[model samples]
Target: MSMSEAHERRLRRATRILDIPGMIVGKAAAWLIVPMVGALVYEVIARFVFNSPTMWAYDATFMLYGALFMLGAAYTLGLDSHVRADFLFNILSPRWQGIIDGAFTLFLFFPAMYFFTVATFEYAATSWQQGERIPTSPMMPIIYPLKSVMPLTGALLFIQGISELLKSYYSIASNRRFRDEDGHP
Candidate 1:
């Protein structure tokens, strides 16, 4: 194989290795929907049929939904499902696309993710230290756990971001589309 091809293979290998944990975490987070839906159903039944409302339901639903949303980000990135202005992007050749994408990933995407990861970690740490709870809730479910998800999500996204960056670099170097795990373009 040519040097560029070997380099591309290595980058692809690295991306695949990094993708595993993000896939697992994202898929696991998807199961949170079951509990979120259950909480909503319970609240509806309790409020309308039983003439009583639940204190925890509102908070539970939002928290669960938020966690679900945040945690699925890395998975979404892996699938390349995040929104992009693909109308113009679709017209570009693979080389030009890779150039733009690699540049953006390096100069913009990585920095943003790094700052987000750092900030969320500090936020979670402070929340944990303070024994924080949802101040608005009567039951006041301990919020540190929910707060903790932020950093976890950030870390996952960062991991996936590295994979994406590598893919971008490989594409730019090879002048071709980076193949998926199944070897699809």
Candidate 2:
């Protein structure tokens, strides 16, 4: 293989390997929907039929919904399903697309993610240390664990970002669409 081809292969391998964790985490997070739906349903029944609203249901649903939304970010990114202006993007040649994507990932995306990850880590850590609970609710579920999801989501996104960076580099270097292990373009 040519040197460029070899480099592309190595990068593709790395991206595929890194994608595994994001896939697992993202798929696992789907299960959160079950509990979220259950909480809402139970709350509806309890408030209307039994005339007694749960203190924890509102808080639980909020946390569950937030967790589901945050936790699925990396997974959505890994699938390349996040919202983008693809109408303009799709018209470019693969090489030009790669160039733009790699530049954006390096100069903009990575820096933002790094800062976000660090900030969230500190936020979660402080919450954990203080044994923080949701202040708005009388039930006041301990919120540190919920706060902890921020860093986890950030880290997962960071990991998938690296994989995306690698794919972008490979596409640029090879002047071709980067395919996965299954050879889908």
Model 1: lDDT of residue 178: 80
What candidate 1 gets wrong by more than 4 Å, as runs, is 1-6, 179-185
Candidate 2 clash pair list: none
Mind giving the per-residue lDDT tens digits that candidate 1 earns over 47-149?
9999999999999999999999999999889888889998998688767888888788888988888898899899999999999998778998899988899
> What is the lDDT, from 0 to 100, of the residue 119 in candidate 2?
98
* Candidate 1 positional error at 88, Å: 0.8
Per-residue alpha-carbon lDDT of candidate 2 for residues 66-184, written as tens digits (9 for 90 to 100): 88888888888877788889899878877788789889888998888899989999999999999998889998789998889998988988899898887777667666777553546
Candidate with best TM-score: 1
What is the TM-score (0 to 1) of candidate 1? 0.91
Backbone collision count in every prediction?
Answer: 0, 0
lDDT of each: 0.85, 0.84
